[model samples]
Target: MGIYGALSSAVTGLRAQAHSLENISGNIANSQTVGYKRMETSFIDLIPDAPLKSQVPGAVLAQSRATNNLQGDIQTSANETYIALNSTGFFVVEPKVGQSDGNSVFAGSNYFTRRGDFEIDKDGLLVNGAGYYLKGLPIDPGTGNISGSVPEVIKLSNAFLPANATTTINYQANLPQLPKTAAYNSTVYNSELLKIDDFVGGSTTASVTGGDVLVGTNPALAPAGPLTAGTSMTIEVNGAPVVFDFYNGGTYSGSGVGIDLSGGKVLDDVLAEMQTGLRNFGGGAAASATVGLNGAGNLEITLGSDYYGTFEVSGAAGVDMGIATGTASSEPTRPDLTTISADKADAFVANSVSGGAITVYASNGAPVNVQMRWAKVDSAAAGGTDMWQMFYLSDSAATGGAPAWTNIGQDYEFGSNGSLVPPGVPTATINNLTVNGVLIGDVELKHETNGVSQFADVNGTVTVSTLNQTGYGAGEFLSVAITDSGRVVATYSNGERIEMAQVVTAQFNGINSLKRLDGGVYQTTSESGEPIFDLSGSGIIGGALESSNTDISDEFTKLIITQQAYSAGTRIVSTADEMLQEALNMVR
Candidate 1:
């Protein structure tokens, strides 16, 4: 019985070693297979029943343990759709069962694999190199979001993408502070008819007589005497001080004032000296203050068209100077450019202009060049409020319409600092705008409150920082690419990149328990837990492939060990047979 038991144990060893050899052979054969996981054979010793102190060594059993958690080397592949997994998750796929109604039907059960060498077949199905179809969630074209939670087989179509109507335009630009135009004359202080500067010099008070203000006798008196020669007076105009000095008989009266108003200065001479002094003071004087005779034959000094403050008198002789008391308050005003007729578009375009041009798409996939012109109609008052009219020119309008330039019926008013003032509404909506028979829908213009501006610029140029529209024309399918988040993006001929679908991954608790199928695919079993589907956050490697996890050197070494063990097992069987034959001979 002991000899027989030894023989049976050696036979079990032979079978176990043969099973190990089969695993090694398969590993060596599939060393270059894509997404292939190496199978490792584990041996267990089966001890026979015996006494408490006597333990009997028995047969061996072989069990296969899959290295499913081990990662494979990622390699680059020429195919664009080929993807590789760098982590523990597997790609959810489906196998084609049969044909139904001339369409490829898929099996109801779900399959998972690391093999991602996928290519579009004739039926637009993304089939992997292992003949399994990839499953993913479809994305909605309108909302650019995933449609549903349940995933289906991803199928691509080469259909034409429809044209989208223009809706919102993100516009940001800097309108020239002082735009250059044909009607713009730098020499002319006030070019516009009803500009703010034109109404700035208005006076509502009566003037003062110089004879009443200058009561001191005109004589050669002491240099430091009051209201006599060498007497100085300071007058403040628009917060700027101007000094006037009386000289002694055509010579400097040793006064500190820089002007030489000698030889009995008249009212005009006093006014001229004050003007020169004011011009040289207060940052070189942006405006001029002058003394002129009004219709009442009274002497009055008017502030400069650019100055916007009251006048005051200071210094030695300011006590007797009645000029500060002879003034009235005035408010700044601007012309309404919107009241102008619609036919004034050509005039506005030709006269006042600083414009920007951009290419926009039409409904029928045609390109339209839109030329926008901002005409500065009225200059700003003391508060920097300037008025500008908006006008547009298109190729279709120029050729077919009666007017070459079309007024958009909009006004942009800028503050003194070149910042755009907010209109009554937040956004400006243009509705039903047709260009070359292509009707554009309601397009909203976004200015960001102060995006458009008008300020002082030496060159008078308007710069557009950004201009983008939401709509796109009809597009033809170009190609498809996958993103890092497992999203499949399809690019088009019209420069539109659309998200078509998102690939999902599946993870299991017992990955080793998965049943291996043909073509590197795995099926779920009761031992393997239910797969958890992940729509996003899967580390998907695009344009690459996963290589086999099997190592050739290790497989070869295992093969050698398996061969030696199998040979030894055969020798044991022969030895057992000889032992039995010797026993039989003794019995004979």
Candidate 2:
């Protein structure tokens, strides 16, 4: 009984060692496999059912212990589609069994894996090296939300992206408080501001004085400081110069040309002096210069006449008093966009400044360049707050009797503080916006609160912060890639990237107890509970892969130990055989 029992125990020991060796060899063999979970050996002692003191250390059994919970070292890959799991989760996948009617037939059997060497196959399906297809929830292209609860095999579409017409344009800009239009000259005072008559044909032309802030002095509107030397202003009436030269106070003040400051001389006295000087000029009578204070406190002069030439105002002040300058013409302007005619398109371009441009799409995927211009129609210096009317090029090549630029049909008004007026409508609709005769449907120009503001910009040009439209031209299918956002994005030829599917990650209650499968995949067992789906992309690393968990040095150590243990078991067998042979000889 002892010899036979010893032999049986030796046999069981050898089998157990062999099983451990098999596990060790597999771990060492798959050391370089991507996402390979190393398998460990667990030994169980099978003692004989006998009295406690008589029970012997009996046979041993070896079992595979899964290291699925142990994470492997994460390595980065150049492929954007490759992904790794940082948490104790697996990627939901399925196997493609057959093809039916030019489509792939899947087994619908859900499997989980950590293998991340997935690449886009010829059929536009993401498949790993193990021949398993990635399963994910489809995402709506318009709403960008996950469409279904159940995960399905992801198959990409290669259809062309349809053209979308311009609907809403998100625009934002800051209008310069003093716009430097093409007609503006910095050396000439008030040249940066707009003149109302420039846009309104046959309208009364206007101008403003720069130097009249009321002080508490008796002549409250007179310049506070005594007139500086060489202070003079010139008004050119049809080539005649009426000069007003300033002199010290109380020294025989002249009303025609030279004027004395203070000494009971008020702002009205200065205007009276300017008016008298204008009357003295030769052709000044033909052009009436009505000089007074507008509502904004700027001394203004209205020029209303049949003068062919311009009524120009230029000056060099001795102090900080604002003076009227810049050439204000009465030539029924077209470049100012006032006397607009179909044949006057060239003049319009010469007056207004560029307000930036964008390309909008038509209904048939046709691209059109929508160019805009900012033309000031009214000004605070002209008895009202600054107002602007925007225009877009409708017909670039319009001939006689045809319209070229069309007004957007709305006015942008600004307060004195460089901001839009109260109850400001930041948004405007460009109704029937036609660019080069391409009738783009009524496109809405959405400008959020404070989107359009009037501020002091030295550039004196519209600064476009955001100018994008919700429209895209047609595009062909391009490529696909994955992101850390846990979404599979497809790129189109139109420089558009759209999310196609959301990768779903799953976890199990007993990760280490899952049944091992071929090609670094696993199956659910009675030990491993049902998979818990994680819609939220947790522990997903994009553009990277997970390396096998097997360590070569550790596997080599275990290999040596198993080999020695098998050898020891063989020695026990040999000893038992020799003893049994001797006992058989004695019995004979």
Candidate 3:
């Protein structure tokens, strides 16, 4: 019984050592495999019933232990789709079972794996080198939220992305406090401002305008003021020139700069005298055309309706006010108060500076330029703070009465502080913004808290701070990428990045109890319980891969120990056989 016990124990030792050797070899072989977990051998003792005084060593059996909890080195990969897990979880995956009707059929079975060397296969499915397809939940495009509880094989399509109409535009800008439009003359007052009549169209009572800041009687108006004892000014009425001299003293001397004074009399001095001097021009409407100050203390000239010719004002002094400089041309009877024609795009453009432009798509993917222009209609000088109207080209080829520019229909007004007047409306929506007859649909313009303002800019131009529109023309699929959050985003030719799917991962209550399958995947075992699904994208690192947990040096050391144990087991068996043979010889 003793010899038999020795032999049995030695045999079991040999078998157990062989099992250990097998596991060591497997670990060494898979040392370079990505995401491979090393298998370790655990020996269990099988004790036979014996008296306490005659107890002996037990027989052993070797079982495989999972190193699934061990971490591996994370290495960065050039592949955009490669992913690695830094924590305790496995990527849920599936395999193609067969092809049916030109489409590969998937086996609905869910497998879990740490292998993340995934690449887009020809079928547009993300598959690892070992042939398992990645699974994930679909993400809602509108809400950008994960959609489903059940994970499915993620399939990407290279189809063209449809055009999105311009919806919301984030806009930020600073409008010049004083816009120098084309009609503005350095010589004529308030010429840089948008004439209210120009946009609204119609000036039954033709008039020339000045600003509200200065009093007509104040000889110290803009351009150059605080007049000298003698200063000369000339004005035209119906193509005829009327000259006058200014005098600050009560008595006018013939020692003045220009002519036409009575009784050595300057009719009631100041600007009123200049107006009286112009009345002698003998115009058909000369008597009716009155040059006077308006209620706001701003100089205004009512060009009577009977006047058929042009009017010009020039001065050797600053008598032209802050309106013009040097030589000048005749101002229009009104401010070209007619609606601008499409052919007059150049003229309108000269009058209005660029508000910036963006390309927006229509319902059918037609693209059009949303050209914006800031046309200042009134200023502080015209009895109000700066006011502007935004216009976009309605049609480039519009003719006759057909409109050219479509007003955004909001009069953006600014305070003297250069900010929008409060009750601050930071956002405005252009309902069905149409350009060149292409409907861009309703678009919200977001200024985002004092985003639009008027500041005194020397350049006198609209400065755009931020401009972006949520719209894109039809685009072809370019490529796909996985983010750290486990979202698969697809990029298109039109510069749109759309989330395609969210990768789903699963964790286990007993990870080591998972049964290893072919191609580096694991199946659920009874000991492993049900897989707990994880969708938080924990420990997922994109653009990298996890190396195998099998350490070569550790496996080599175990291999040496297993070889020694196997040799010792053989020696024990040989000694047991020798003792049995010697006993048999004695019996003989």
Candidate 4:
């Protein structure tokens, strides 16, 4: 029994050493394989039951252990689909079960793998070098969000992306404080600009009862009694405010200045004073204004050709001038350059100043050049608001056919701070907007709070900081790439980049306990808990690959040790056989 047990122990030793050698050989063979884990053989001694003083010799059993958790060296690759895991996780994948109609059919069972040499196959399926298909959640094109929770073999669409109509446009820009345009009326009135005296049925300067009638009337100019000599009157013009000092009437102050009423004092006297005050308010020499009566018996004050702004009149606590009572009236009509006719529109564009332009896509995928021109219609004096109108031309041929600028019909008003004052919703809608004969329905312009503004820029230039429209023309599939965060993005020839899908990853608590499959893939086992899906993990690296964890030098060292142990096991078997033969001879 003792000889037989020794022979049995020697045989077990030989088997255990053979297992170790097998593991070492496997490790060495897969040294260059991507995502290959090294297998280590563990030996355990089996002891037989015996008395306290005596012990029985034991054989060794070899158990193969997987070093799956060990990280591999990462190397960058030019292939966009090649990905590497820097942390403890594996890419969820699926293997093809069968082929149907020349297409690979998935078995539906999820597998985990570190191999990520994925490339888009003919069927648009992301297949790795190991013949495993990558699984992930598809991203919705409209919402740009992950659509499904259950992972499936990620398939890309090579179909052409349809065109999108221009729905909403986010625009941000600054309009010049004083916009230069041909339509801006530098002169308030083309003819005799005047201030009328309805009290006297004539103008203060013109003894003749003709000209544009001043709307308001003043009291009869009678001889004054003993009164205070120091009284003041204020008139606001184009935002510039000026004060005029008035003395005891019949005659006021400034004997030789243009405001002097040394002659027969009438409405003309007050008109002269207002004109002089306004001229001085704007630095006098360069500034000029005329005051007289109009055909309607109204007081009219017209600014010079270069000075187009507002005006207001008010008196001090004790002033007696009838002119200083209420707010002044602006110009009758504001000038507009946009005409309904095409030829006139072209002329307007040729003569008028242009602010900025942008290329927006039409509904039919045609590029439309939208030229924006800011036309100063009237200043604060002209219309009680510093007003400007922006016009757009969608007609491709502005010179050939009737090139007309479609009026948005909204005046962009500016506050004193150079910021935009929303007239209503601060949005503009273009109805039936046709560019190059393509009817691109109603395009909404989003010009909320900060979308558009007007400030005093020395350069007098309008800058469009941001101008993006939610629209795109039809595009052809160009290429596909993966992001570090595991998002698969597809680019198109029409300058459209869409997120196609997101690569799914899984981590297990007992990763080494998972059942190993062919080609470095693992199947979920009872010992290995269910796959825990992770989307935003920091392990995935795109355009790179993970090298095998097996080290050739270390595997070769183990191989040498395994060879020596195997040889020793053989020697033990031979010794056991020789001893058994001797025992048999003694029996003989």
Q: Give each prediction's root-mean-square deviation over alpha carbons.
A: 7.2, 9.8, 10.1, 7.0
lDDT of 1 by residue, 280-322 (tens): 5622122555554444434455445543334555544544444
Q: Is candidate 1 or candidate 4 better by lDDT?
A: 4
Evaluate model 1: give its TM-score. 0.72
Count of steric clashes across candidates, in order: 2, 3, 12, 26
What is the TM-score of candidate 3? Answer: 0.70
TM-score sort, best first:
4, 2, 1, 3
Better of 2 and 3 by TM-score: 2
TM per candidate:
0.72, 0.73, 0.70, 0.76
Show where candidate 1 strays beyond 4 Å.
Answer: 171-240, 243-331, 336-357, 371-442, 445-467
Residue runs of model 2 more than 4 Å from their true location after superposition: 1-10, 46-59, 187-189, 202-347, 377-383, 414-426, 575-588
Residue 27 of model 2, lDDT score: 85
Please provide, for model 4 over 1-588, each residue's C-alpha lDDT reduced to its tens digit, 9 standing for 90 to 100: 376777778788888888988888888888889998988898899988888667886777889998889988999999988899998899999988989999788778899999999999999999999999999999998888888799999999899988887777777787766544443344533111111111113221201122222234432352221112465555555455666665544554453223333344566656565676667664321166665555565445565443234456665511242343655645433333333346566445533456566667776787776767665544444324555666777675656346466666666776666666645346888677666676777888787766777776665556778777888899999999988889999999999899989999999999999888999999999999999998663688999999989888888888888788878877877887898789889967
lDDT of 3 by residue, 463-569 (tens): 99999987788899999999888999999998999998999999989989999999899999999889898888878999999999987888888889999999999
Question: Which number leads on lDDT?
Answer: 2
Give candidate 2's error at residue 89 in angstroms. Answer: 2.6
User: Higher lDDT: candidate 2 or 4?
Assistant: 2
